[model samples]
Target: MALITKTDLYFTDYSWSAIEPDDPRVTGEPDSTLLNRKEGYEILYFINKLSDIWSLKNKSSATKIERMIRFEVPSNIHSQLTIRIWIHDNWNESRY
Candidate 1:
């Protein structure tokens, strides 16, 4: 059997005040808010490449897979936030 390694991305330090309305640092616009802070904030992370090397050795067998990702946010922030995830096979280097 081959070893499967896993990694995770953790997000923290999110506070209501940091993203509240009328936060000048968020944007120069008078009505700036966390909802429209900037374009760069839209992306969370990117994986350069993902390959199923094990598939080559087990071509005739089907691999059973379950939920491989878990997203957890503090209960306190759950009601006040919106989260989105996007998966793309290719990404721009500059975006990283």
Candidate 2:
């Protein structure tokens, strides 16, 4: 497969896929992000995974980063969780 770009991920606040092994909702917009249910916990799992990915891929150029994720498992998801990313392109792909 070809290398993936950061934007491809930003499109998702969270992801739920067997390929990456992360739950959904983690990447959903906070205000729009749903929690307090199975979907919420699923999102949490996804947030953790994204954090891991962003750290490894965007560490140097990442001017800002936040999972905006809060709350413990089996608890109510935070109403005001937030995540941010510096959004620097990691790959050497040339853009005209």
Candidate 3:
């Protein structure tokens, strides 16, 4: 259900963007294993705001959440696919 839209990082210099090397849902390379099997269920949709009209267009949730996957099996595709977003900290990773 995530239509491949991404842009949210207040950045202290974090950068990585590599897509289209025969992209089949990026089957394992960037941080180990990612292939949303023929395409589905890689949902990373986030929205946030503390309210009091601090409007990020009015979202009152999502401190942090993440997911990623994009794929195409057929159809005359031009803009292929990719949406790798995985940074949800899981208690700061002790194999959470």
lDDT tens digits by residue: candidate 2, 1-96: 112234432324444434333323444334434443223334444444444554545433221222222222223433323222212231233121
lDDT by residue (12-66, candidate 1, tens digit) is: 3223233334334332321212232122121111111111322323311111111
Candidate 2 segments exceeding 4 Å error: 1-28, 48-96
lDDT of each: 0.21, 0.34, 0.26
Give the candidates in order of lDDT, highest first.
2, 3, 1
Q: Give the TM-score of candidate 3.
A: 0.22
- Sort by TM-score, top down from the best: 2, 3, 1
Candidate 3 lDDT tens digits, 1-96: 222233442222323354554554332233323433232222222212111112333111222222111222222322212212222223243231
